[model samples]
Target: MESEDITIKPADKGGGVVILDTKDCVEENLRLLGDTSTYQMLEKDPTLQFMERMRGLLEYGKERGIINEREFKYVRFPRVPVFYHLPKIHKKLQKPPGRPIISGIGSLTANLSEYVEHYLQGLVVCLKSYLKDSIQILNQLSDFKWEEDMFLVTADVTSLYTVIEHLQGCEAIQYSWQCTLF
Candidate 1:
């Protein structure tokens, strides 16, 4: 396996290609965590209390009928997070934002979020379909009908995710699930 990233491209015709340094990005991440250095330097073994907390959450889900025993049958231990960055390219920004969101597919919270991941993609598709009609998105329209006297307006939701409380979010999920299932 390759340990480091290497790029070979055509000769930098007048202007050169800037891969951009990852050190600044790494420093930003460490700063956000208030750590002295990279997160790997501080990574430690999972504590017994951490295991207990995860087990408690799983048991609570079972009690609430949110998850079945079958789903947890093959899950024994939580996995540690393996962090990787996906480079982000923006049209207007001269330099890459460089600060991309790190996704932990193999982290301690991964198993606990396995079920949530099931909805993440489906929610995106469903939301796209719903907004397609309401927002009058051209390509997503199946059968577009236009009226002469119609005026269209788009609404913007500000801080919808950040402002919503956990309980409210859960209630919204529960209500939507019930409506879809029944």
Candidate 2:
């Protein structure tokens, strides 16, 4: 791909390199959520609506001395619309039939720093698995005398947290964790 094609114009100074377009990212996220059964649960849970109603009811109940101020102030509930994209697999056909498929998943979490560290750790594990698979494929291909050029490309989102919209970032994290939790 050309430089312009690959380049992602950052929304802010600290944001990392983003090769995939925003729309593509959103689509990929949706696909991941759908594939992993996260989307279904989200659809079933009206979290935002429930929160709004709860807040109103709590406030009203507090006026009637039914609930305390502490309860109202620190009503900790999972926020809706957590933004996290599913892993993206990019397949490059170096040679027609035997191309290797490489995938990278990115998450924009509420706690960016923590998420970055977590993403890095996950990436390491993924890379190890991918490397092992590639080696096996290469060994098998060599034994069969199948001469085909192949390359595996691994990519990462350099700094995701600082750049994404706060709402979207939260959504991404929620979606990502939902998959794991479920």
lDDT of each: 0.53, 0.47
lDDT of 2 at 130: 43
Q: Pick the candidate with the highest lDDT.
A: 1
| Candidate 2 global lDDT | 0.47
Misplaced by over 4 Å in model 1 are 1-18, 27-48, 60-69, 82-84, 92-94, 116-139, 147-165
Q: lDDT at 179 for candidate 2?
A: 55
Error of 2 at 126 (Å): 31
Superposition error at 159 for model 1 (Å): 9.5
lDDT of 2 at 42: 44
Candidate 1 structure quality by residue, lDDT tens digits, 74-175:
345656555433333432223333332346565556665676767654654554235534356665444667689977687755334445787998887776
Query: Positional deviation of 167 in candidate 1, in angstroms?
Result: 2.5
Off by over 4 Å in 2: 1-16, 41-49, 52-67, 76-82, 86-182
TM-score of each: 0.52, 0.27
